[model samples]
Target: MNHEISNQLKQNQDIRENLKFLAENFSGKIVFSTSFGIEDQVITDVIFSQKLSAVEVFTLDTGRLFQETYATWDKTQIQYGQKISAYYPNNKKIEGFINENGINPFYESVNLRKQCCHIRKVEPLQRALKDVKIWITGLRAEHSPNRNELEILQWDEQYELYKYNPLLHWTTEEVKDYVTKKGVPYNVLHDQGFVSIGCAPCTRALKEGEDFRAGRWWWEDTSKKECGLHS
Candidate 1:
């Protein structure tokens, strides 16, 4: 382990011990958001196997998700036998936006993309998190350059809750190995070169030798790629 990381974690203690401590500290009313990706599956397994109580598991149904993603969600529910709650954008809000800007406003500009994401993800995510004290996610430090400096445990000022990333320091290979070894369900698009899966209209498989995140919002500036769902 990097001595710096070891010391940092030692301050909170390592992830394993810290998780138990946090779970006990905030025993009820915590939530974990899953996108049916590999990282999320791994985190889900951890939360379930550890028997964390009152942990609400939820997902955003953008209404434009890939067939593979939806299929994975079904498989995961059966495999885990857990009620993974689904959140959707309000029908009125979606219809109003679509009527005003047409069905695919994301193709026009980054701002519109953010707006769509806000309706489909951020708003619903906030609602799901309303009663939760801790927000668990499958975010990994290596997934994005901007996320490289994130700590395993930190307060999300935007959400005003403790954000936990159990796989913060895990590598892609490590995540894949874990999922494969444990037989966790994940988006099959990953096998076809999609490193990150999101709204169906906005995401695609990365080209050979391309950046891992190039497939997401490919039309926008790579530096400004996020839709603010995870930002």
Candidate 2:
């Protein structure tokens, strides 16, 4: 491990204290990406409640988000009194793709789906991570089988930054409890069994015994569910 990661682990600090340490000590810019899910809301609360400076919080507006997601986004800003920057897809690229294929071409094949995701999510994420040295996220280990192998702090070569997952070890129940106790703003779809929220067309509510990630890209193979944002 790097000295900073080692030090932070040694300290055994809480989320806010560790984030404060990163805000003060990390050399380059620090940024957090939120989708306004319950996990992200908890981290947002930590950042805003502690008043951490030098930390930029932003979200990717895929243009296909649910109304509830937008409402939660507004509520988060109002509750924290912080401006969360919004990154959007390249309109030209989206228009070209849609014209060539169709609006919902993602439902046809994996390649088309990945293409839409690249234009809508992965590309915007690249723009968001530009010039950032430390990228904070609300990823939890329990969210997916792939995520279970991720460390709390790891290098993301695609983004060329250190990805920090503050809630890596946290469970869904724990996240919900924290959000409720802290009164953090979250999407109402979560209450309707939406374990993971993403673009409107690709997401749905999970049934009993379903994995947390089952709600996202339910039509795709389990191995190909992610939108390449975290991959």
Q: Which candidate is the best by TM-score?
A: 2
lDDT against the true structure, per candidate, is 0.81, 0.89
What lDDT does candidate 1 reach at residue 32?
A: 84
* Candidate 1, backbone clash total: 0
Write the residue-wise lDDT of candidate 1 on 1-231 in tens digits: 235533444476245565555566666667889998889888787766666655778899989999999999998878877778999998899899999999999999888888999998888888888867778888887668888978876778888876778778888998899889988888889999998899889999999888767899888875657767666
- Give RMSD to native, each candidate: 3.7, 1.5
Give the Å error, residue 1, model 2: 9.0
Q: Each prediction's TM-score against the native? A: 0.90, 0.96
Best by lDDT: 2
> Which residue pairs collide in model 1, if any?
none
**What's model 2's overall lDDT?**
0.89
| Candidate 1 all-Cα RMSD | 3.7
Error of 2 at 34 (Å): 0.3
* Candidate 2 residue pairs that clash: none
